[model samples]
Structure formats: C-alpha cells, structure tokens
Target chain A: MNRRDGDTCSSTPDDSLAREERRLGWTLVAPALGVVLLVAIAPLAWTVWESFHHHDLRMPWLGRSFVGLANYRELLGTPRFWASLAHTAFFAVASVSLELILGLVLALAMQRASRGRALIRATVLVPWALPTVVAALLWRFLFQSDAGVVNAVLIAAGVLDQPVVWLAGTVTAWVPVILADVWKTTPFVALLLLAGLQGIDPTLHESAAIDGAGRWRVLTRITLPLLRPAILVALVFRTLDAIRVFDLIYVLTGGGPGTATEPVALYTFSALMQNLRFGYGAALSVTIFAVAFLLAVIYVRLLGADDGRGGSTT
Target chain B: MDSLAAACRASFLLLVLGACGGGRADPRPVVTISGSAVGDEGAILRRQMDRFMELHPAVRVELRQTPDDASQRHQLYVQWLVARAEDPDVLQLDVVWTPEFAAAGWLSPLDRFAPEAAAFFPATIEANRWDGSLYAMPWFVDVGLLYRRTDLVPEAPVSLEMLPALARAAMAGAGAPGGPPPPAAGWVWQGARYEGLVTVYLEILTAHGGRIMDDSGRVVVDDPPGVDALTFMRDAIRRGVSPREVLTWHEEETRFAFQNGDAVFMRNWPYAAALLADSVRSQVAGRVGVSTIPAARGSGGRPASALGGAQLAINAHSDVPDLAWLLVSFLTAPEQMLERAEAVGQLPPRPALYDDARLAAALPLGVRVAREAVASAVPRPVTPLWSELSERLQIALHSALAGQVEPGPALHTAAADMNALLERSGLRYGMNAP
Candidate 1:
C-alpha cells in the first residue's frame, strides 16, 4: 500500500530511524541523568552559590551583598584551616597506604589454603559491618591512659614506669584515630582485593610454577600486574572514604588534644553545624570536594585503571 | 433516574472526604524533647504534659531522651534549631544559650506571651533575660559546687590560694602507709575544653573580683585579676594535684572519679551528691562534704558559681501561643516544679518551691547547693552576642592553660573578638568612643 511495505520507507527511513534512535537512547538514559542532577549536581550547585553569601541560622534570608572570595580569603589566612588541610592530607596518605599494604597481605593469606579460612572471612566482615561510632568507642576505652588495658599491660611488664596518654598531646592523637580507621576499613580493602585475587585463574599460577617462577617472582610478574586494576580501584575508593572520615574521629577524640585531630571535614562540620557559619562552611566544603576530585583524577590517570565490570578482568 | 441517584451519592461522598481532610484542629503536633536524666522518672514529664493538654485538649507533647553530656546534646540540638522547623514548640534551652540562641533570634521572647513569672528565683529569672527582655522562663536550675572528702579535710577550701597544697596533702594521706600512691583521683573538675570551660572560668573570674564583660559590656578580661585566675588553673593542672585526666574530664568523668572516693576534693554540680551517698555505688558516701568553690581573693569578692539550668518558652510563630504558654506555665508551676525536682532531679525554678520540705528531703544536698550557689551565681553575660564571645573565652582559657600563649594575650584576643561580635550585634561594648 505505502510504496510496498518492505520498501523500508525509502524516502524517510534514515531521518525517521535517526529520530527513533535518539528518542530510545535518551529515554533509556533520562532517569539516570535525572537522579544524578537531583542528588549530586543540585547540591553541588546550591553549595557553590551559598558560599558567596554571609548568613547564619538566626536570619535565614538569601542574597546578601556579593562579597566575592572574601570568605575563602579569611579562611586561608586562618591557621586552623591550613593545619586541618595538613592533617587531612597526612591522615589520607597514612591510612590509605597502610590499608593497601595490609589488604594485600590479608588477601594473600586468604588465597592460601589456610585452616579456618571461612571463619576468618566471616569474622573479617564484622569490623566492616559494625558502625564507625561503635568501633571508635571500643578503641577509645582500650586506649584510656589511666585505667585502659593497653597502658596497664605496658606498665605491668616493666616496659614503662607510667602510663602515657595515648591521646593526650596533639602529635599523639593521630595514633588512636589512624589505628581505629585501619582496624575498621582495612577489612573492606582486603575484601575487594580478595575478590580480584580469586578472579585470577589458578591455572596461571600453576603454569608459573611449571616455568620455575619463584613465589616472589610469581607475585611480582603475574599476580600484581594482574591485580593492578583491583588495587587501583580499592585505593581510589578507600582514599575518598578516608579523606571524608567524620564519625570515627569525631567519636574517638572529638578533634581534640588541641585540634591536632582536626581534619578538613571536621573543621567544615564544626564551622557550619556547631558555629552556625553557613557561608564559610559552604566555602570549606567546596574546597574539600575540589581537592578530593583532583586526587581522584590523578589516581585514574596514573594507574590507568578500568572498572572490573567491563569486558576485561584484572 | 438510576444514573442520577448514583451521581448524587458520589457527590455526597466527595463532600465528606473534603471536609474530613481539608480543615481541622491540629491532628496533634508530634513534638520531641530530649532529656538525659529523665530515666524511669519520665512519667512525671508526661503527667505534667497531660495536665497542660487537659486545658487545651488538642496540643500533644512528646519527650525524647538525650545523653546527659551538653556537648553531645549541643551537636544534635543545633541541627534541629538551625533547620528551624516549627514542630518543637517548647524548647528547654541550656542557660548558656541565653546569649547564643537569643542573638540568633531562634528563641521567642516571653514578653509576647504575658506569663505569670514573679515566683521564679531572681537569678534564674535574670539568667533567662537576654538584651533588655526575658526570652525564657526558668524550668529548673543547676550550679557548680565544691565537694570534699570529710575524712581528708573537715573544712571548706579556705581560699583559692590554699587549694593546690590542700589537694596534695589529701592525696598523700589517701595513699596507703607503704603502698603505691593513691589509686584514686586527688582533685577533679570539668577542665575539659568545652562549653563547661566557660562556666568554670567565669566562676573563677567572678570570685577574683574580675568581670569578663563589664557593666557596660566591654571585654575586660585582659586585666591583672583575670591573668591571676587563669594562672591558678594552669598551676593546678601542671602540678598534678588535679589529674592529667582533669584536662579531659567533663561532669560525668570527674563525678565518677570523685564519687568512687578517689578524689579528696572535687568541683562538680550537686546532682552527683545523691548518687555518691547512695549505697549502690559510692565509697565515700557518708564521708563526702559539700561547699562553695573557694573564695577568689579578699572577703569582698566571694566565690561565684556558674549557673546551669533550662527554661520553657512559647514559640512566637506558633498559632496556639495561648496553649503553648499555658503548657509552659503549668510545667513551671510550683506543684509540678516540686514533682519535677523530686522525680527528675530538677532544682525548682521558683524560690518558694525550695520551702517544700518533702521536695528538699528528696534532693537534700542538691537543694542546699542550689540555694547557696544561686544566691551569688553571676549569670554569664546575657548579651545576644555572648555565644561567639563564649567560644573565644574557651580558646583563650585553653591556650592559656596549655601554656601556648600568656593569659594576657589570650584574654586580649577574647576581648577583641567579643568587641567585634558586640559591635556587629548593634550593642555597645563599654569602651566605645562615648
């Protein structure tokens, strides 16, 4: 009837087909785009806009005088901000580095046919499952300078004459916080790396053995190169998490011992939430997000990592 | 004819639905109030709330339990206040917030409600007043007091100067004849760097005949007397007469240490006295003694205690201010105040409630401490801007104690910041060009 049904719309097929393709693709992706805009894009935009205004909780009127970059300028001059950034960088680099190494060892340990492997796997998930606050409180109790078990043991063994306040001085507060973070989040890193290790075929290891590859050589030559993507993914994920840590440090020490434990997130939190300086808090948040995003960019480019869910494996 | 009948019935149903959903008395404002000490005695608050509801019969009240520590409570309460949602009509504001919350305009002033407020303790009354007006009504009161182990010392701290030596001597006695030093704390206080720091610092300053902010409300802590007070705090800590933990101890920790008979002298609130003397936990229950914080300098400048209490205020924006004020008044009435004091450990908001023998018997020591402390308790500066000034005080006191900066500079910093805050708030600090 319309120029024979099988003619494939000879006059209008390409244009119609193109329109159909665009409609189907866009409709399929529209929901995901909407979700991203609602959550990530909208809040980010709102925070950026709020950063330019000066306001507090008492009078919540918007659109004050445009004092461009003044809030950021004031913050840069403040020692607390600079110190907190230094603290954040130190915490991120130290925690993530320790986690990466510890996670590798744990995965390697689990890879071997060790007794109680299932039990260890099950128990390893406990720290990962426990709320961050719970872990912090437990560790805080253990580290109490006066009556804590750690100090008691040290004193009883004649190793030291008296109990040292593990969280007393600014320099020392880092120990308890990093120790808590490592205890709670190291398991997550191990679990991710373990998945990668397990995904590698055992035949590859067997072939390396047949080729007279030593354990060290096999690990360096085959296992590590194969596990690089997983490691990179784990590093990126944990680095982001470590940088934004709040509850663990908040509950453990409360950014105390003279603000030695003050991380950037905690600083922004105290400024915005406790101090009720909304505009300054927004500026600080924007700075943190920018730094974290830059770190992510550096990680992806240098490691050249890809998501494992893609066509190729580690 | 059948279709017309069906249409008539559908329209009737629609009319009923619209009537039911569209307009009515508030279905019940779901309110949440947090308390740490309510415990099993929470029914007292509910029953009192029920009495308020009887007069109105429509407004509902709910009380939520919060942890006792003010810092932890500060974190959650700020989130709610900042959000400024209208559901929580009545808030029990900490006395320290008289400046901060009032300055922020978060509180609805009591002047709008026309409350019957004459019976309240004048200090408590004055404590709730911010600027030239009253913002809240006293619901209860708590003030810091000094506690000592009678076995160690039968007298009050004779003077602020004598405290360090007395603590050292008391500790030596507590140590066994040949055994190691006493496992117990020697002296305990809320030396932790927090809002509590402000309360304790002001107590010392007032005792020393120094004012943090003067009559005209200029920052005046940079003087010699202020430095002397701060020096005493630093020396007390450095000498180890007070525990290293004192630098970290808030009310509960210090209370725990002192109540366990570990401390010879402890500075804390009166609530700890009952718990310590009760057979359940304390070692020095009968042996414990109560008094004021040591005198500052001469007889003229007597020791001043930091007043800690809460109040009930009607939300200005509330559609039912009458009912809200009604609820607030009933909760603070003498009869309910007596019940709240007896059950929830609240010191009565009214001066006359102190005459209730039954209430006193329930909280004997707490009442005694309240009467003595409130008589001379200097309210923290009631200027709306004092909250920012308070944080500056904390930083000053802390840095001075840590030996990071001299007390002179620390107080100077506090003064400058306070002056700026006061200026921004449209208030004059005394030193203005006038």
Candidate 2:
C-alpha cells in the first residue's frame, strides 16, 4: 500500500486525478465488500455473541443467559474434543501432502503429454466434477464388508481369506476416508498446478539441458522453484477443506465403530444438530475458524519467502 | 397540490389497514401437516388427504413430506420449533420424541380435544402421555419382532439361550438332503452408532428383565441384567451366531440382508414383513415368519419389544389449533389406519384393528404376531433430555458391542451421564436421585 501510494504521488502531477482513481477503486470493490459483510462477518459476529451464552434449543425454558467462558472451558477440557482435534489435524495433513505429491505428478503428466491431452485432462477431472456427497456415498458402497465389490475382489484374488470390516476399525477407517478424499481432490490440485506449469518459460528448460543438467536435476532446480506459488495456493485450498471435513466422514463412518474416526467438524455438527447445544457448537465453529486462519497466515508467509527467492515469474 | 399529496398518503395507510383486516376475515384456515412419506407411502397419504379434504372442505390441509431419515427429520423439526415458526400446524412425531417435545413446551396438550385413546394399544397411548397430559396422538405402532426362515428353523426359538445353538444347527443342515442352502448370516439387527441401536438394546435389555428407567422414571440400568444383556449381544458376535457385519448394520442393511435370504433370522419392525413377503423383491416370501423377541433364560415375563412408531402432535404456535387437531384426529382414525396397513403394511395403533376381518384376511399371522409384540412393547426412558440421554446410551451400547468398553462400565457411565444431565436441568424427579 505504501509503495502504491508513493508511485501514484510521483506519477500524477495533480492530486485530484489520484483521488478520483482511489474513489473509482473503492466503488468497484463496494459490492464485494458488502457481500462479505453480509454473508461472512455478520454471522461470525452472531456466532461470537452466541458462544458466550447458555443456549439449548430443547431447553428453551432455561433462557438465553450469559454464561461467560463456560462453554469454551468445557470444550477445551473434554477428551473427545482433543481426540477430534487430533483426528482433524491428521486428516488435513495426510490428505493435503498426499494430494500435493500426486497432483504434481499429474500436472507434470499433463504438461508432457503430446497426444489426447484434452481427453487425459478431462478423464482426470471426472472425480473432481462429481459432488462430494455422491463421491462419498460411492466410496461407502465400495468399502462395505459384505456386499461391496472391494472385499469381493480382494478375496477372489487371494488377498484375504475373509472380508475385513474396513469402517469398523479405528486405523482402517481412516485409510478408506483418506483414499476417497485423495481420489476426489487430486485432480483439482493438478488443474491449479497445471496452470502454473504453463506460466514457466520454455527457455529455462532448454538452457538447463544445454548446461548438461540431468532430468531430475532440472526438475528440482527449475520446475519446482517456479511451481512454489501454485503449490502454496493449492495447499491453502486443500488444507482448509480437509480441516473442515464433515460430509465424507459423516457418510462413511458416522464417527463410529466407537467415535474413533470422528473429526472435529462432525463433533461440532453433533453438538449443533443432534444435541441442539448452539452455544457450544458456536464456540467449536469459532475454534475451527481460528485454526484455519492460523494455517493460512503461516502458508502466506511461506509464499512470501518463496517469492523472494525466485522473484516474479508470471 | 399539497392536499392531493396528503390524500394519496392517507389512502395508502387506509389500504394497508384494510388489507390486514381482510386477512383476518378469511374463514377457511390452512393447516400444514408435516411428516415423512417414503416410497409408495406418499401416494397412499395423498389419497388419504384427498378423502380428508372432501369431508372438511372448510379447512385446507397441506401435506408436506419430510426427510426419510429419522435424525435428519428431527434436526429439521428442531430448527423450525426453536425459531417458533407456525407454518407446520401439525407435526408427525416419533414415539420416543414425545417427552422431549412436551418438555420444550413446543407441543399443545391434547386433553381438551377429547380424542379417545381407549381403542389404541395401551403402550402406544402410554408413550404419548407426558406428566399426565396427552401431547400427541398415536398414529401407527411398531415393535421389534424376530423374523426367521420357517424352512430353516421350522419353529421359533422358545428362549434367547436357544437361539445361537439353533442358528448353528440350521447352518450345519444347509447341505442336508432336500434342504435349502444356508444363509451366510444367522442373525442381524441395528447395531450402528445411532438411536436405532438404543431401541435394539432396550428390547434386549427389557427382554432380559433389565429396566433402564423404572416405573417412577428413575435411572435403573446399572445392574446385573443390564450387563448380562450387553454380554449377550457381544457373545452373539463372538460366537458367530450373528456375523461381525452386524456391528455396522442399520435397519435398511439388516432388512436387505434378511429379505435377500442371506440371513436365517432378523430383528426388525413390522414394515419389513410386507417388504420381505413381496415375491418380486424377496427370495424368502413364503418362508419367513414373525415371532416375539426371545426372553432371557428363566425370565417369567413375556419377551419384550421396543415401541417404534410416529405420532401426530399439534404445534403450540399454530394459528389454527382446531384445524390442526382435526387433521391429526382424521389421519389417525381407525379407517385411515386400516387403509394404510393394507396399502403399506403400517400397523395400526388401535389393537382392535388386529381383529378387523379385512386385515385378518389380508395378513393374518402378521396381525396376530404384531398384536402380541405390541402388548409386550416397552417404552424407553421418558425425559425432557431424552435426546441427550439416548445419545449417551448409543455410545455406551455401541462401545460395549464394539469391544471398546466393558458392558458394566459402559452402562454405569451412561447412567451417570444421564443423571448429570437431569440434575443440571433441575429435572431430578426420581427415587434414585439424592
């Protein structure tokens, strides 16, 4: 903002032109700002107010009285809350990191493919195009112990003597969940990184090859350096989504076989919808938002450092 | 010009007042009735509503189909009721939701309506009452009954202790000369982590002579029979009488497995009977039989079943309470109930319907068995914090069934949690309370 101010002051001889430019910019952004205030900020403020009160839909006669930090204190102290937080963190990190590596491979494939490029791209995007709920349901059917084709194929191929209840085990439940999420979202990350791959100059690869650089060396020093920004953007999008994961796990596990695979968002939903404890659920929502905000800030800082190292490429 | 502008403003104000008065003057009130109508049930309900509308043309009844899933429907109702919206004048309530809805002051007491409950099954009517006032009218009734293949078992097991040995023997006889192939599963029921698990557990617990909430509404499940009930379920899985997949089974899963002839026995509601008997959809159409859930060894009482059904209640905020009551009463009338029973296999709440000649001719065995099951049906704990208590119980029963917690500890923990919830809400009104 300071650099922009100095440039405007030096380039314009008259102050009125710069002032008019500023007014025009504000006018252009006014609609977007109004939308953000109405849809995001207003609800966030209401949630904040609600988090400090005693509110249960089924117990309306108790009245919506101020309860201070009681809800927060109870949530923080609960073992289930901490367990859910751990599950959410593991889900986010595992899904994002796995998607990043797989997505990068797909992005490279898309960049190098010389035939049927459109077909390959479209086929890769099919999973992403399907709705999350529908994809989750499909995966649920595939993982069922008795009727699902997964166990049927495995047993037929001598992979197992008996069918395994994939959703009943604490560790095994997460395997299907993570795999389903990766299958659905890796294409999205690939699309973002594919756009970044196109922005790189062909001369960089040509020059690296002329210098006798090997294929792997060229990839590490040149392709990866240019891809940092895209990777960061993809990471932010996927991480935020993974942290707020609810629908997939809700459909697949219903947080069960003993609440082993329950994520924090499902916990929040149980409090809100099932238990009707709005104040506690609001506090949970605020905590989740705060966590996402912290992760975004850290990623943005890393992005800035990456920019300084490579300078602007696009 | 000034007078003309003043005249326009005055006329606009008068028009607004006149519009408000005109709305109040309309006599034909619309009472919106909300409930779930899954599959062909919607068509039957529409026909029933058509008849209702013909009789009372002065009142227009708008029928709305809610989500098929019970939990989703409950959530939608909570959202509407908490906001105090009056659009849904009549609500279709689950039998278990009576205490919770009544305590919230969201449902209008129906004693003033003078709707008779004498013809209805006593247990169904008892479930509708809260604090000596009827908050809902029982529409249809359901009870958990053991469905088995008559070809395999030949006769229902007389006691719970005999089930495992009987199932094992039948499975062994699958390849016997002139015998049908044995199913992969011996027994299956709802065991996933939800309210359905609680109902299933309550049936088994009560059948074993365990009382969750005593007659005075006290917490009483932390006892020997409670532990024994949980152990019996765990043993079923461990002993291979019920497949391990039963842990993940809900109503639909169990129904699918049983109706497909892939299981020897199933514990499900009466709705499964008609579906299983449909020759087009099921392989066990002529072979399946409904029997009461088996009693525990040496228990003198009849085998217990959990009451499962939807009821009709008037929303307290309804603008036309009289019309809502009329719709509720009309929908639950014996004629309509019998029509639904013949059309969709819904069991009527009225016990006299079992003796109705048409119903007996259509499905004689089902009516007789359902009547017996309803007579022994035990209602779960009735409390304002029913949803909360039911959730804790689901966790308790599920954890024990999953081998994550011991039965004794699980039941004790659930009882403690329920007591804490009740005490926190200042609803301590039982002998067990301090």
Candidate 3:
C-alpha cells in the first residue's frame, strides 16, 4: 500500500516507507481476525463445551458440570426432538422446492417482458420486503378459524362445512407457516434469478429462435444451465434460513397442538427459556450448529468445485 | 498462555467496578420497585415516591415499569436475581414465585427488615413465608374473579351448572340486559394453553370437589369431578356461550373482547375492573361487576380463586438494604395503600388497607370481592420446580382445550409428568406415594 513498497515487497527498496509497509502487512489483517475470534470462535467453543456439561437456566451463572455425552444422549432419545427434526425437514424441503419452481417460472416470464420490468420487479419485492412479524400477523388474521378471512371465504364457498383451526391443529398449522414463508421469500429467489436471466446475452436466444430451437429446448439447454450458479446461491441462502426458523412458528402456532409444528429452534428455546435446561439447550444448539455448519460446507464444496464451464447451448 | 492474561483482565475489571462503586457517595439513594405503568400508575408512582422521599430524606424510589403480564415480569426478575444485579433493589414477585424465589436464597429474609410481618393477613403472610422465613413483603393481593354484565345476566350465578345455560340464554337473547348478550356478546377468559388456562381451570376445579394433587403429592384430579370441570369449559364454547376462538386468547385479547363490548362475561383479576370503568374506552363501562367463579353443589369446598398479585422483596445483593425495606414499607402501608391500589387497580396486599372507606371506593370491589378471594385463595405449589409444573400444566390445558385428548387422560398424563419432575427435583412427600 505504500509508495515505496510497490510490487517488489519480497525484496523491499531501502526506504523507510517500504519497511513500514512490510511491517504493517500482517497488522492490517489483525482487526478482521480479532473480530472473527471474538464473535465466532469464542462462542462456538463455548457452545461446544456447554454441550458436554449439565447446565440449567434457573442457576444460569453457576459452573456447569461436564456430563460427557449424556445431554446428547437425552436429545437423541427424545421423541419430541426426532419429531421436530422431521417437521423441520418437511418444512424446509417442501417449502424450498415449491419456491424454487415458482421463482424460476416467474423469472422466465419476466425475462422477455422488456416493458415495465422495473415496476414489475419492484412489485415482486413487496412481499419479500415485509417485516417477518407483520407478515406473520397478517397471515394469522387471514387464517383465523372464526374471524379469519380464509375460513370465511372457504365457508361461504362451501368448501368447508365447519371452520378449520388453521393455527390450532398440528397437521393444519404447517400449511399457513409454509404459505407465509413461501410467499415472503419466493420473490427474493425470483429477483436473484431475474438478475441472472438479465445477465445472459440476448443474441444467443435470438439465434436459437432463428435456428428453430424451441422454447423448451432453449430453456433447458441455455437458460437453465447458465442460471445454475444463481439457483445454487439462492438454495444455499434459503436452506440455511429455513432451518433456524423461529419467529413465524412462535408467533403463529407456538409449537403447539401436541408439538406437531415444533422445529429445533422451538425445541431448543423451550429447553433454554421454558424448561430452564441451559446445558441441555446448549447441547441442542451445538447439534444444530454442527448440522447446519456441515450442510454449508457440503454445499460450498460441491457447488464451488464445479467448473464455471457448465452445459449451455446457443 | 491465556490463563495469566485472563486473570489480569479479571483483576482489572474488579478494580474498575470497585472504584466506580466507591465514587458514588451521592446523597440520593435510589430504590427500585417494579409496578405496571398502566391505569393510574403515572400519578400514583409520583405521589407514593414523593411520600417515600419525604419520609426518608435520603431515599429516592425509582419505579421500574413492569409489563402488565405478571409472568413476563417474573421472568425479568429471575434474570436479574440470577445475575445478582445491584439495581432493581426491590423485586415485585408473583405470589406463587415468592416461595420459590425465597427457597433459592435470592431474597433477603424480611424478619431482619420488618419484624412486624406478623400483622400481615394470615394467608398473604403464609404465602410469603418459605421454610419459616418471610423473604418478601406483600405489595398487593390479586385473585381471579368473574366479570359479568349486571343488567342482563342474573345478579348471582349460584352454581356452576347454571352458568353455561345462563351465558347462552343471555347471549342468545333471553332477557339479559347488562351482560354483552343477545347476539352481540361472547364469553371471554384466558383459554390459551398457558398458566392462565390452568389457573382458570383450578378456580373451577376446586369449586367442583376436584384436587390437582393430594396432601401427600399423589395425583387426585383424574376423576369425574375434574372431567366435569374441563367439560364445563368445552360446553361454554360448544354451547355458544364462550367462543371457540377463545382457545387462542390471553389476557390482552380477552381484555379487548370484554372491553370492546363483545363479551357477556369475562373471568379475570381485579385490575380489569378499573380498566373497564373509565377507560370508557371500555364499552361495558358501567355494566361490569366482579364476583367469584360460581360454586358447585356438594363440592365439599367453597368457590376457589387463584392468587395473582406481586410481593416486594429485597434483592439479597442490594447495597441499599434499609432504603429497599423502607420503600417496600411505604408502598404497602395502610396510609398509602389506597394510593397504590387506586394508582393501579391492584388489590391491597395488606388486609388492613381494606378498612379504609376512601380506598374502598376507588377500587370498587377491593375491600369486598378481594377480601373474599383472599379468604379462600389457592397458591400454586411452592416447590422449586413450580416452573416445570407450570409448563406441564400449560401443555395439559392446551391439549384439553384443543380437543386433542379428553380432559381426564390429559390430567392423568400431566400428573405422571409432574410426579416425574418432582422426583427429579428430589422432593419427597409421604402421602404422594400411591
């Protein structure tokens, strides 16, 4: 960065500036490392350590006794934990699958609509831009059994003879949460895909059209392949988010009607906050961090390892 | 390598904290008391603190505004007490938590602070005493009471059997006048699967010859009477007396329901009456009246109400011990009892405060209904595991309210889980063993 340091820092010029620059190189990266150490490494270590200890919320400040793998044993043994894991899996997988397909379709439709794409794009972001709690409350009101508009509309149309407890019963509760999540986040995916779509050259599409490459073939061979990186990015972003979902589930269902919609976040929260089992909660937290961390590493490696030269057609 | 550095850092922090602690020889000593910032709290806090300051020239009472929900406030207090923060010297404890908090050694035992604790109401005093030590002083008394429209519903709901039919007829148009009845009203209360639901249920359960746990800690409520109590709750909704949607309601939602003039009757605490009255924001302003949950015939017991108020305790770590005790005394004494009660619609913790005619008028039913409720109130179990018990009760009540399982099975399941928790906590009772 110094004037005398220039490009030959391995053998610096005999100037004070070059010597100072060489001395400051490591110092420049120190702040970033300090931040990472404080925020991530320390807490991550504490969480891992706490997972092996017996801690409860009532005596939150006391020294935790190391209990080896007992907390993890209990977590794995819990029917509640397994059921919640299944519920979270279903939520993330089903919701993300739907969003990806819908987002891709929307991006394709908007790609060629050259007129007013900006306005249309802005309109799509409205759902994504809403605060989560506000979105949840709006959905909860509309989905209420008695006063909710969805039930009222359904009942009026005779689709339901009796009012269904949208947020009450377990099987029925996830529908609204999934619907809310998909509605709020799919536009985000669409916008990303739309950007990717815009980045693709127009002449290739025009040539494909002139050569009688049909719409499906052009999409399959050219657009979809080229958009793979964008799709992977969106998937990575959303999957991580959907795994740790708390606010919506807490506000809407509160992990209720017999723990049907309970996810790991709600599970760990009850352990920590409600049950006052801080050590056990720590175990759950560590487990989730490990699983999610593993998933992130897997995706980054799998996707990053693939060459940018992926399949595409003109 | 890091251990020596960490020790240095710790000593440095201690020196900094110690120096800061010493520099504060300020004449004004601050004492914090937790109270809701609702109703007339703004005026009442100013007047009471002014009196407190005048009485003790060195003391300054800082009112820590607590949320209306006692449970949430209890949570905050738990965090403070666990961390042993010096501020918030006076803890306003939920009546049930007084025992649990006392047992945990978080509160300064009050015999050392106020030796005149014997003058407190027997029940209120008993509630504050844990293992022969009074760890807290009473701030106010609260009991869950039934609120009904006086003009429309019958003046006295004599028995539990008559309430559903009466609520329905009045709501469905059978010459009910004061209650929000006749096609416009709904029956409202805490129906969400939480502590409130269990509290409401216990009010009816005890009235119906039911018991949750026997003197020995054995499960006693898994019988016909318990089912009847739960069935009555269901009947209220199925019979169109209370709305089915009440299952999702908490205090605020129910308050909104009754205050907005949509409910014929609401079961709540004494604080609700003040809110209903000239918050003429409240629709059923003049129509509301407080009474006991209806008693059941041949139930062996009188109507039961759940105790739901706070007690002031000195945080054991507080440096201004005398100031904290003085603040508690000033707030709960007979002279300022009305000021505190009228400031907020809390029932006076001191039974003697009920004797004041002026104070009685401000609270309306403070002297009468509250006194009756206090006379036969039930406190939640005083075990250290009360937190766990409360959570289990919420789940059981939720299951019952959602129609997931019949009430009897749910209570049985809850009792089993509770027994396990109690066993886990190393609490042994002779009679609790089958």
Best by TM-score: 2
C-alpha-based local distance difference test score of model 2 = 0.83
Writing each residue's lDDT as its tens digit, candidate 2 over B67-186 gives 666787787788788888886899999988887888778899999999797988877887778777889998888788899888889899989887777778877775335655788778
In candidate 1, which residue ranges exceed 4 Å CA deviation?
A: A1-19, A59-63, A114-117, A199-213, A305-314, B1-37, B51-61, B64-68, B71-84, B116-118, B174-183, B298-301, B354-362, B366-369, B399-434
Off by over 4 Å in 3: A1-31, A57-63, A115-123, A144-165, A305-314, B1-27, B174-181, B184-186, B218-224, B428-434
Local distance difference test, each candidate: 0.74, 0.83, 0.76
Tens digits of lDDT, candidate 3, B1-434: 12223334445535644664565556686887665544466577677788778878877776665545555556667777778888678877777787667656788888876457756676677777766788777777778898887766758587877776667767667544453335454568888766788788888888887877778775555667777788778767666778766777777778877887677788888878888887548777777777888788887656889876778788888988888888878777776776667667677766666677867777865468777887788766655566767777777777777777777788788777788767655555531111
Question: Residue-wise lDDT of candidate 1 within A1-314, one digit each (tens)?
Answer: 23454466464676678779999999999999999999999999999988887766533333355667877997898777998899888999999999999989988988785799899888888998998877888888888877888789889999979887776556666888998888888889998999999988899999999999999999998999889888988989999988898888877777775566779999898778767778889999999999889999998885753454444754
For model 2, what is the alpha-carbon lDDT of residue B100? 81
TM-score of chain A, model number 3:
0.88
What local lDDT score does residue A288 receive in model 2, on the 0 to 100 scale?
94
Which candidate number would show the highest lDDT if scored against the true structure? 2
> Could you arrange the candidates by TM-score from highest to lowest?
2, 1, 3
| Lowest summed lDDT window (length 10), candidate 3 chain B | B1-10
* lDDT of model 2, residue B294: 86
Counting only residues 3 or more apart in sequence or on different chains, how many pairs clash (N, Cα, C under 3 Å) in candidate 1?
0
lDDT tens per residue, model 3, A22-135: 779869989999999999999989888888988764443344678999999988987678988888888899889999999999888888687998899899899999988668
Clash number by candidate, in order: 0, 0, 9
